[model samples]
Target: MIRELYRQYKDRWLLELTFDRLLRWNRWWPQHRDTGGLLCWGSDKVPPDEAAHTWQGAAYESGLDNSPMFDGVPFNTKTNQLQLADVGLTSLYIADCNALAELAQVLNRPAQAAELRQRAGTYGQALQMLWSEEKGIFLNRRTDTGQFSDRLSPTLFYPLLAGVATPIQARRMVDEHLLNPAEFWGEWVLPAVARTDSAFTDQNYWRGRIWAPLNFLVYLGLRNYDLPDARKQLVDKSNQLLLKNWRASRHVPENFHVSGVGRLPSEALNRSDSFYHWGALMGFMSLLEQDKAVELKKTTD
Candidate 1:
């Protein structure tokens, strides 16, 4: 988002204003959430009476409230961290370090840029260790038993966004997982969980519902690779989902049905917010693809 803001507005002042704060946030993850060098979703020590301040607080920190990924996962009361080395959080932190490094260079802070780059590399290597060659995707590891969580979500695709996946690994992930009809790909592009997963039938928030932000983030990850077909399919389907709901009741939903069943916002179940602004990201994907097409045409012409 900072990159897009700078691209459109060239606002150095805004970047400068957020750089130090972002740096602190980047550091905070490793400091507070680090579990053997890989980060987990966690909270600082809070009063016991604080609502959602325990395991639920860690889930909230993941921005994936009630995702099945956190289901039954243990929390370390001693550390205030989930007992899982989250692939999503680790990949995102690597991406964050890379983005902060770019911003540091843009702001003429060479030392900070170098530091951020080094951090990215360290975390990137650690994230790569999460990959399951047998599963053809990265899985979250239980910090307690050192077992990989079989529960899969779009968050697993984030390694591509972090630029940590090799091209061959990316291809395998896209082919074996992302495009699998029984999993993510279908009438709807990407569901929060694999369709075959038991949680998918729940059709609940972050369980089986389709989220625009998840689609958008996965789309960005696709852009990092040579997967043009997957990328186009995602953009087209996301646009269709947005337009279908928008034309029906002028609603942009926080999420959509995996089966493409829901239309009206009022019809949304499982606390899916109707008319949420981030839902517009579904349409934004199309707009970005359109821009890319136009740029390609110009170059060809």
Candidate 2:
């Protein structure tokens, strides 16, 4: 779909901006590790002295906002180096590179397409290097020590979205990790943090809340692999959670309590944008469900 968009409208400002961004994304170091490389801060953002020692220098770039994954990791804003390489970021980086390569090919830039494709393949290789057979998941690795993080988050499955995982790997991720009752699975599904992780018990921020966008991306990933059953499970659970909240309060929220437990909290900390656009992903899921039903009916007939 993204490739089609670029092909259809390469002259548009959006694609131009996208091309420029991918061209400049060289700030990320993909060769430093096998699982992925650290994305350094742009030279304009951090001073050389502060780039290696403080998380305060760089805002946590992963959307989890205040995830505990960076609790003690030092970030250098000047050089854009953190001690760790994120599996999610790496996988997405590979996907983006591949997308840009396709765009370049559409624009008749054969050399540019080849370069971007090579870069994408390299990043994909590093992403695979980060796999943990023991955990049945891809994990973040320390840039300096090559250690993997024990904490798990919904973003852990992003390799599927990036097409960085092989069929076997995706199957393990889905069956052994994603659907595991002790991990991501819950009544509403896909918490920001795994249910068994220590952070899961914390209702604060990205510790354990359900975010609409993450689930939507994971749903797309499942569909990419033709995992219709898994995809439907996520779509149904997501829509159910959204409708339950909407029926009760007549609002779409920015995020929600894990599993839709209890009433959507009224506390200031728990309160979110009452009508966030992303929460309307439930409507999108509804369309997907409808399409699936139509397809099923056709098959039966």
Candidate 3:
């Protein structure tokens, strides 16, 4: 389906690459900083990767984390700390870990290869430093401040998505944090930033709105951690939100409000389309089937 979608929108994607990725006038490098990966889109924002940080060149496009691509072969951990000269410096710390883990899983599964080991180290640091045991969620860090964002965004599932979190941690996040009535539980899987959060402002930070791509990541992370029931609920919520937007606007919005308030069409054609946020709104069939599978397992058990 993803392949088919890509093919269907090949023309538009080429344009996105041109307008969003490339520089004009026969420039070899893209105008957007090549963090060796993709940059997070903020509302009128250029992530640190392009401006304050540097990219060495290897980027994970699927991730929303801040990573800098570097020219060196393998980053020598002992000799290296983050430097402004490197691209991919800033990342949604957890998202990058999950992306790396999946890459490791695909290439190394349960192996303890060198690359996997390095990734594991990162995973360890992420969980240890970034996870809020009290909140049962992961938080994004501004790095410069050394404090976690008080607003709870869905970026915490990086470890769960990456399969780095233990089953216990996954279950806690699912049962407590993500599903808690006071926390993230939503008609959909909750907004990128819960409106209830003090920092949530509709026009600020990343448009002060929910984002489909990040929603997609959180959903996958939960699923990866084997939180089947929570995953089902989230998938169902995603569809409901998508349909709600479609019903209201005759098309999907890039994101909706946690309280189901803003169902209007996305302001621009950026990344809110179903085709683009393919991760957030699960196709109805897939979500239903998975829910059925989980139900069947529960019944048998």
- Candidates in order have lDDT scores of 0.88, 0.72, 0.47
Report clashes for each candidate as comma-separated counts: 0, 7, 24
What's the true lDDT of residue 254 in model 2?
84
Weakest 10 consecutive residues of candidate 2 by summed lDDT = 34-43
lDDT of 3 by residue, 1-301 (tens): 2222334564444433433121132122213322222222221123654422222222222233222111122322222222111211222333443333343333334442344346445435444555667776555443233544555556556566555577887788678777876656755556554545544544332433556666666766666665667777777677776766667666555455454534334544443443334433545535645666898999999
**lDDT tens digits, residue span 102-175, model 1:** 98999999999999999999999899889999999999999999999999899999999999999999999999
Compared with the true structure, the alpha-carbon lDDT of candidate 2 equals 0.72
What's the residue-level lDDT of 157 in candidate 2? 90
**Can you write out model 2's per-residue Cα lDDT over 142-178, one digit (the tens) per residue?**
7667788888877779898889888888999999988
Superposed by TM-score, candidate 1 places the C-alpha of residue 220 at a distance from the truth, in angstroms, of 0.4
Using lDDT as the measure, what is the rank order of every candidate, best first?
A: 1, 2, 3
| Best of the candidates, lDDT | 1
Candidate 2, residue 209: CA error in Å?
Answer: 0.2
TM-score (all chains, Cα) for each model: 0.95, 0.83, 0.55
For model 1, give the 10-residue run with minimal summed lDDT: 261-270
